[model samples]
Target: MRLTDMAPGMRLAKDVYDPNGNVLMRSGTVVTERLVKALRSWGIDEVTIEADAEDAASAMLDPKTAAEIRALLDQQFSLSNRDHPVIQALYGLCLERALGNR
Candidate 1:
């Protein structure tokens, strides 16, 4: 996709690289507006991103709505076995992705 059409919170489907072939960012890194500006300055014009079916719906949610959902998720996760590193990691990733509306 064209970098111009990208938005913050979109995940990269592939690694990005400089003209010299040095990796700029790894695959799965979330796109940010600041990163977009930097990439534009570096002459990058396109990127491959994950195709999310719910992205359009999620984008409509305001930060406040996202926060509310996060709070609910936090309450639910409190009952889980957070002592396990794997569960903690999973919850952390879920928190980041679910709260990406910010």
Candidate 2:
């Protein structure tokens, strides 16, 4: 079956072929929500789940800032210099205001 047809946790094996029908690699576990969320928290969208295609594709990536973020994440460094702090703070404020601090 095609990658698009498999369920979230299902596994499938078939002859893996490149565009020229040459074996490129073998089957492996597909990307999952946990993996995608990990990437999301890092402000990167490299690993994609079939279900998150639209959101992943439409994500607003700031080229200049994303490059910096990518470098930080790749180096296992910090993002204190980026706007994530403010963005997350605003998100928390909005949620608290909307939900009344559950």
Candidate 3:
């Protein structure tokens, strides 16, 4: 979540930590004007927030799309030994890129 998108009364989904590793704000902390200002002063730009199940699911690749991507990756990597560790890692990265995860 972008700090600019946050509004008063919005609750945090996860704990926020400072660069020093100290807890800045706990999960479920309600956003307030003062807190927003403080976060800005601390150079915080984004934060994780609780997402609905539908929203989370929408961000993930569906099984069919995943399988299609995997098959394509397999074909692309066919010239290399699929069983080789390095090739397998490359395949994983290719799949991630194909699925828009990276």
Candidate 4:
């Protein structure tokens, strides 16, 4: 998963390593915002993580379809406070629905 996808409470599925091959985190470490910040500082871009069923399903969403759905959602939510946490979460739920329907 990329840094953009990482979230607190997600569990690592494998060890994370630095460029020099130093282990950063062992498997099963619960992700935290601070840890994500540290990884960004270390220039780590991606790490494998255990996926829940919803995540697994979302991973199967086609890129083109997902983009299209997001575009549609953006238009639908154009008037809302997109920066608000509630708005962002609602957007996520809508995107999930849009993709899952296909």
Per-model CA lDDT versus the true structure:
0.73, 0.38, 0.69, 0.78
Clashing pairs in 4: none
Assess candidate 4 and give its TM-score to the true structure: 0.53
Backbone N/Cα/C clashes per model: 0, 0, 0, 0
Global local distance difference test of model 3: 0.69
lDDT of 3 by residue, 1-102 (tens): 667756677677779999999999999888888998998899888665554421343346687776777787777887999899677556654554566552
lDDT of 2 by residue, 1-102 (tens): 223322355322323443466653344545455633543454442221232332232234544544454454435424343357675444333322222212
What's the best-to-worst order under lDDT? 4, 1, 3, 2
- Model 4 segments beyond 4 Å from truth? 53-102
- Per-residue lDDT tens digits for candidate 1, residues 52-83, read 71345355678578668768888988889988
What is the per-residue lDDT of model 4 for residues 1-102, given as tens digits with 9 covering 90 to 100? 666766688888779999899999999998899999999999998776664633655767877776777788999999999999788667766765576579
* Per-prediction TM-score to the true structure, in the order listed: 0.51, 0.22, 0.50, 0.53
In Å, residue 45's CA in model 4 sits off its true spot by 0.6
When sorted by TM-score, best at the front, the candidate numbers are 4, 1, 3, 2
Colliding residue pairs in candidate 3: none
Which residue pairs of candidate 2 clash?
none
User: Model 3: residues >4 Å from true position, as ranges?
Assistant: 52-102
- Superposition error at 94 for model 1 (Å): 31
